[model samples]
Target chain A: MEFEVDEELLDIFVTEASDSLEQWEAISLNLKKNYSADDLNKLFKIAHSLKGTSKSMGFTQLGDFIHKVEDLIAWVIRQDREITASESQFLLTTHGIMKKWLTGLQLNGNTPDVSEVLWTIGEYLKGEIENLDQLNTSNNMQASEAHAATETSQRTGIEFLKVRSDRLDSLIQIIGELSIHQSIITHSLNNNDVQSNNFKLAVHQAAKMTKEIQNESLALRMTEVRGLFQRLERTANDVAESLQKFIEVTITGADQELDRSVVEAIQDPLVHIVRNLVDHGIENEEIRVAEGKSARGQIQFVAIADAGGILLKLCDDGKGLDSEKILEKARQKGLIKDGTELSENEIHKLIFLPEFSTSEQVTEISGRGIGMQVVKDTIAQIGGTINIVSKKGEGSEFHINLPASLNMIDAVVMELQGNKYSIPLQELVEIVDLNNSKLEDTEESHPLLNWRGSLVPLHYLSNELILNQDYAVQREEGSLPQAAMIIKSNDNLLGFGVDRIVGHQRIIVKSINGEHENNDTLKGATILGDGKPSLILSLSDLSDRLKSNHRMEAV
Target chain B: MSEAILQTSEQLENDKYLVFRVGTSYYGISLSEIVEVTEKLDTVPTPNTPDHVIGVVNLRGEVITVVDTRHLLGQEKSESHLNFVIVVNTDKGKVAALVDQMIDVRQINKEIIEESTSSIQSEANSHLLGIAKAEDRLIYILRFKDFIQEALSRLNGER
Candidate 1:
């Protein structure tokens, strides 16, 4: 027997299988909460399509496995009975195993052994194994092994967004036409000595059209956060089940949209937050009830589109953060000096410090070394901020504010050492005129600026970035900076001195690729209105470098 | 007879190269690797880049990193002069290389290329595929992909 596999067909099958399994998992989770016939029919159709594709692709073993699952679904549909909790669990577990097999097929060009899963499904079909408990007890080890395999193979898959062909075609066509139009405008403006009012008006209209097209193109990458919320729901369910807790996960504004890249980047931090909430924030049933709260803890995910950004609130109706305990822990860990005065909010923020875990005993759920610091860092990497608000017993709320798009940002351009650089407006506290402001220069340390009564360390941007040799020479000769931009990093205010302040404008950032590793000074490059590339300064990174240097000097 | 014809056709398909001048030397890159050539545009200086990299330029709406051919090939930097940017397609993306002048697109057969020897090998010349003698000049046929790979590896190594 000879078999020839069509590589393209296999790729299509893998993509389809991956997508179908994702839908199956989501729908099955939904069905578990409330059984709906329409949802069940959707599952059946997915299974049927998968079976047909697998069989046609000559994956008989996979086809057989799906066939048996299809038969069980058909039987359930025929009986017209609402599935039990254990039945839904079995289906979810089956979904997990099939997904594992799909990953194996994608990676190794053939499906892995699924005899245990097949036999379990057979028993379910024959009414021998009636519940998930029996299935778990019988094949717990095998199930775990399958899960491990799935986790190992997870890195092989690539993320893809599915856009309609016509939409893409139109986008391409518009872009082509837009470039042609731009060249035409430039040609006339460059060649013609005099510009008429009509020509100027036409150019204005073209610019407006270009802006609209840009917005339209950017909107194409905007996806609803529903998918991310659904994944979080699944995580919450799994974590709650493992910890023997009851939690009702409610989501508001799941339809709110974010950039696809931002959504993907935020998934891990969101999942970690959910797990931490379930494991530590939410109390157990007995404790919750004794504390005059509902037995089923409430975890709510609310996303709202605010001005130029999205605000996500993850609220848990559990035992709130104990500021006293957090402060005590911080002191014990030597994170803060003894008798350090702090507000309640500052104490609550201590949990986000590295190696700050309030868990007395390490658990498999949340406290396995990865702490809230990682969550904060991940959020910060995407130009977002996470803050916490809590009361002693009224539960805690984590507010995450993220920009609508990752690439476009409003920035204040500054001239430094004859070169232009921009800083994200969100990072700027205020711009101060050096000539008008009170500045203190001493031989002992870096110059400090008395900004609103508090002394802030002032660093010359040109001197720090070494933009050119002349700046260093000028600094040696004691030349004063023209202006200073105030930046807040790590709860400390720092002043960055620059040559002059340019006006603020929205710029699209483009990553500077190849060989430039010193990202602490430069975030990326952006093309200015005059068709020149300008660097975007990373204020946080600069502040971090300054803080580390300050610490080193103190030592 | 048919096999000979097929072989000749394959040779014809692979023999074309775009030759250009950097300093006093000539270099050839495979025609397939080149996306386009245009008059050099003003480049804004980037911080923390290698000396060979002449910062980035705005090409249409996209920002592209431009590499200086003189510094890359270890030749003395040229003063004020007109140049051309030959945009080459690599595995990563399109990168534009600045050259002193565009010579001509010449077809040199694979059989005429002499394999590079150790005598002329240097850090930069290591990226050369072979040397081809045509008319009165020797064109150093560059393995452009390898050059890109080396540049990326050097960047990573710096990190």
Candidate 2:
């Protein structure tokens, strides 16, 4: 028998299958929270669609797999039984297999072997589910393998939707105020003003609806951090096995939603840090047993939202940082002078210096501290900060703090010579009242401020940008340029003078063409709420420009 | 037989052009090449670019580069601000040519269009093809692709 398919049809199948499987993967994560009728229906519809598309396109095997999944979903919904954790994981693994098989089919008409997956689903369908104990053991052995094969390893950079979270937050905040006003009006009208609580209740009801709509829209732009955690888990397993060690990664807060661009930027650094844990942080089984601990090493990978940022804590119960060795290495590298008393935190931070490595011997599994500098550089590049806390013989924890979203950042809007400009909120260290701050060289030399114990440079943006000012009108003499936006770039702190601080708003940035992109001062331009182009400034670019200018003057 | 017939019809209509004036000088580009003509846009100047580049304008939510056609032709800059932007399609993407006004469209025969010598003093002459007539008024027919290529090269080189 001969079955034929055209190239165009195959292309459509691959694209459609990839999208469905990706959606299935995200839903499989959500089903962990609470199973709703809508989710079940969505799952069933997706499976049925895949089955129909594949079968009609003459892909018998792929269609058969999807058909089996559809049957399982239909059965689960009919029975109304709570989906076991193992069942959900199995469903996710099936999506992985289908997606990979699609990739294979595209390359050469080869299909994946899903008999193992089918058998597992069959057991659940027949109500002869595998015991939890058996599933746990199997999970320990297979969790790492399946995750590596599935989404993360082969996944493209997560899609970045250029939108403003600040704008969304403002909308959310406005609706909140409207509801509050309704409550106030309700109290007055019921007693003295009019005579109706219905108006108040209705306003409250409208607010609730808007709130739900806001949450749903926000959810569209965010994905669970669990997908990233799984990639790290896979790295741990591969590296641990290669080093002949046993390591298990347990993750909590896997449901934290994150911006795709933040996830993309942190993926490589997270991999490096996890590989370091397996190769250096976790002790060998024999050593663990001798130390009165379990033979298998344990790693707790946690993700949580904390204080306006995403916090990732990677901890391993293994041999902690050897301070003696690190101190010696630091001294040898001339990072610190002899007999210099430094705090434990400062000593640990020395590992991030250029070319600093404590790994005596390098192997295939990434050497610890070898690319710690790279990890540090990358984290800094993404507007993130890293901290290391460790105690000898106990364990080590690396805490990384990253902004909530990358594409849309909160910006402080400033009024400069009647033009609106914005500076990123994260880059601002403080805003100084120039009248209170002491001026160092106001008249003759370069302008510097006596900031606390050190001198900080002051750059007038108007002077730097050489903006033409036609101040045809005069101001009152005492109306000094009082406010300044102080930002820290590299190790230098500088102040930019603005006429007025207009307040903060979330902005979506659009790129400027050729020369402006390479220009040191301007980051990009964003259209204002009033439909005018406003420039977003970069302090790092300003600092670099200042330093170069200062160097040229000295020469 | 059908292929020969199609070629004949295409050649007959190929000389049809849309005539527009950038300054006092009148010019014509192929009718098929213009994408749109828009009222003066609120353009934002990009710092440190070539002098001929007026700026970029947000045209119906899409940003397109705007060029000062008078300066590109090495003629006197327009005394009065020219507000109309003639949006044209090119291999390099869409760009707007600043012009004082849009004149008219006419079909010209090949015989009446006299080819110009390449030795004209202005650099833009290399891109201007020949002189033709539309209702007794002379229209300067242009090979716009050459002009577009020159514009793209300047954009890249300046960067």
Candidate 3:
């Protein structure tokens, strides 16, 4: 008899198995604190369900292994005492094996050979009999703590339709096309001066509909960060155990949702940061006791939906970043000038510089200074910024502000030498008439503009960006550089001398992946209402480039 | 499989190409690679871009980089506007190639194309696959990827 796995049933089993494994992890961590019959029942239900599903699906080998674990779970439930540490350990081991088999099945069509795992689990089940007397009688509480979580999950009956990501991508592309056409229609209508109110109203409604559809399609790609945080909790525990330290991980705002792509992109950096927290951030129990702090150090992972983006913070109450040590290392590594004076923020940022690890001892964890630089690069790649703050004995917090979405932005359109350009709206402080604003020139220093009583360095659009050295200075009669944009990034402000303001619009940004992708002055290009590609300017990138003024002339 | 694709590309008359004029020279870009062709539109010149870059223009909803074919062909800068854009789909995305004039699409016999360019002295036309004869004119078949590769190398080498 051939045992052939039904494709549909295997899919169901895989989904159910993964979900059950996730729940198993959560409840197992809870069970570690106090013995809960409800949690045990939930876990038992999952094991029994998998055993039944796998047997029915004809994966007899997988079914048989789970059936053994199910028997052990039944025995544990039948016991009159609180679960012993030895029994609990075995229970966790059973769950681990089940998770591995299910994951292996997902990656490959066939179930893994679990004979060795089955033998090991059988040994633990056999050993569980001798552990019955190990439980203290006082620890067993026999009353029903309502299985509230299971009740809620059953009542909610959350229904989700799995969608191929490519379909959503196609939907977005169509919406992008719709927006472009809508813009062209509106542009033509306005140009031709259509007097019909009904036609104008319809056009506005269509534009609004396109924007809504774009947002909804974007929302489809978002997933809550709860799963990410839960997994990191286990990672923290493992790192702490290896380091022989006691560390508690507290994660908040786990329900906050980010684009799945953004989450995937940031997960590695987050993992490294958490690993650093457990390895380098948290001090050992003995050292902590000497410092008059709790022996168990705490690491907090918090994500907050901020004004324009998500603020992810990883703070640890352990040994803070040694700023002096970092600066010294930077000097030793020739990363800094001999007598460079830096603010505390700049000093803290030195750790992110290449080959600037302050730690005297290198470890498998993070001492090569590779992790922090990776953290910096990953965050920057997503147009996010990271800032570090620390107190010597207290702790350190890494604040990461990631944009709410990656491919879309509200942009202000402007013109430089008759070409349209889009600048992120968040970066533009205000737009002023260049004629109304007073301007002054300097030879050695940057040009100055007296913008509303404050002096700002002003740069001509074509000259600053070097788009064309030969743009006809011969303008029509009295137009003295039509407009100037007050672009800002943090505390630095620069006035961009432009020819005209093209108003504001929300645009879907398509990334320039090849050829000009490495261009520092531009972020990506977007289609305008008139159906032309306008380059989106990165304010931070522009500010950095402007301050340096070293690379602009490189070409 | 490669031979089958080549056979289909041959399809009795060989591959279809979108031929255009750069000065007196005629160049052929594979028809399969072209997305759209348009009369010259207003282009916003990107600052500090390579000299051959015509500018970035709005094509439907795509912001495609426009490259001047005449500049790459090393012909004398024409006094008249290179007012035609042939948007080609490259591996990177859609980029518009500027031409002084556009000719008609024609299937070039693969056997007629001269693969070796030793006799052709123009470095600008170094990436030309070969010259193919059709009717009364000789059309230069271009290797699109090779042209972009050479352009990038030249840009990098310029610095």
Candidate 4:
């Protein structure tokens, strides 16, 4: 009888198999250092489930292959053996082959040839491959080749994410409704002129609960960074092995929680950074010894929740980023003019520029001239910033700050001609009271305000925003703006004048659909505490607009 | 019997349109395109948007852009308050249109609807699918997808 594979069932099996394989790989990597019975049982369970599911889904070859792996794991568990380095390496190689087969299955419902892997496992089961040295000589070359193929194919396939439960989604929805209802209650109370202290206290307490629920619901989307750090550790090890270098990698804050989407988006850039550290950033043994440093290079990855975002610091104790070499490269590439004096920090930043590579010879690892620029762009795409700090002959540290959640941000609510608008608090350097500052009207169309002994261009919020005629008329008759929000845009200070600073609050940002999406002045829209929709201002875009307007005026 | 069956199948294809007034003109959008008809919600004016987009409004928890139908149809901006917002599902998302009044939904026959002629085809009226003759009034059936795409293109042009 010919067997027919159910596409839907096969897809489920594939997703389940991929997840199990990831768990197996992570556990095997961990078992290299610390071997525990519980972890071994987890491997066994994962392998058994994968085997059963693959068989049921008509992937018998894959099932039989995993069955052999399961037996190998069972043997280790039965012997109560401490996983030596060689055994752990063997498990990891098995994982690599399984992952490649899974990717092939996902791309096109076919698994690859697994006879070689099965033969190696057969030898191990038959006691021919007993020790570390023999397994290494037999499998290392094939394993590295398989790893390369898996990496490329995995990049081309669709990434499967862990499915979130419907209950979490409903909870978030209910929290949204609760917040809206709370605002309605507040609005009604204010409108009815209820001045009773007890009633006010009750409403205030309800509001507080609503805010807490909103925060907790948002937290449901967060996941720990441990998985991401493990992948990075794997990448570091692989790069170090390929380079034939000895390195020590230290990681902290593995339990730091970030939005799942943020974690997924950051994985590639972090991996690239890790590879660069292992490849170009760290020096080899001879150079390190000659520099009076330890022979083994050290790389540290630290993550901490700072302010309202995650701060990731990747530091490498190696021949630090040589600004002179970077400057020379920048000059050779005509990226900078001759005799242009740049500070050491500025010179180090030149590496992030596109097509900037200081490597004398291009290696397979990094110097094809596309790594750092893409890293910077990816980080910036996720509302994050990356900065480099290096001291000559000391080390280089990359500081990346990313928002805790993409949709929620702390914004300072302000009024422009009775219409409420919000500016992300992170963008504002300081809020200056225009009433206290001196305004100078120059030949320029916009006014300049004196801020901290320097003249900063001041833009009236009403004039800059595309307001209706009524607001424009009101602005013409109203008094001068009372506040100026000083923002640093492109390293220059610009002040935006508004009617008044209402207050600061955490707001859930919702994208404005249709025509307004393309409006650069508005980042997005958010519902305020009063259940009113307010526009969130994009300060950087606004600055760029103002700058262009000035240029046009000059023309 | 065959003629009767043919008539019934054609009638099945006929759709009910929700008619609304902008200035003196009445426009009909198929019911499938509409999400809800709501009372005019408060809109916060967005800067740098096209003139037809009055602003965005908070509908339930979602913020939807509100387009002024009068301006979109090349009529003078409404002086009085728009009493109704017809929220429609567009390719972009849910967008609400400000109208002077909400007329009754009517099931218009496909046979009586006249395809828009090239003589009436201008940039403003390009989104009109056809004109339906119902009782004593002519309702311009709006191709909502095209209407939204045109509005978005106009916004892009302004930018």
TM-scores of chain A across the candidates, in order, are 0.88, 0.63, 0.78, 0.81
CA lDDT of A402 in candidate 4? 92
Q: What TM-score against the true fold does each predicted structure earn?
A: 0.82, 0.64, 0.79, 0.83
- Per-residue CA lDDT of candidate 2, range B1-159, in tens? 999999988977787787888766788888667778778876655433566776666666555567777778767776255768888776556777777787777777778888886565275778877888667676788877568558756764763
Q: Give the top-scoring candidate (DockQ).
A: 4
Task: Please provide, for model 3 over B1-159, each residue's C-alpha lDDT reduced to its tens digit, 9 standing for 90 to 100.
Answer: 999987774675437888888888888877766668899876666655677765677766667777776678787765255879877666677777778888888777678887764656375556677888888898888876568555644543442
User: Relative to the true structure, how large is the alpha-carbon lDDT of every model?
Assistant: 0.78, 0.71, 0.71, 0.78
RMSD of each: 4.9, 9.5, 8.1, 5.4
> For candidate 3, lDDT tens digit of each residue in A472-505?
2333554556787887765777887778888988
Query: Sort by DockQ, best first: what order?
Result: 4, 3, 1, 2
Residue A368 CA error for candidate 1 (Å)? 6.4
TM-score of 2: 0.64
Fnat per predicted structure, each in turn: 0.36, 0.01, 0.40, 0.69
Worst 10 residues of 4 chain A by lDDT: A467-476
Q: What range of 10 consecutive residues in model 1 chain A has the weakest lDDT sum? A: A467-476
What is every candidate's C-alpha DockQ against the true complex, given to 2 decimals?
0.27, 0.16, 0.39, 0.54
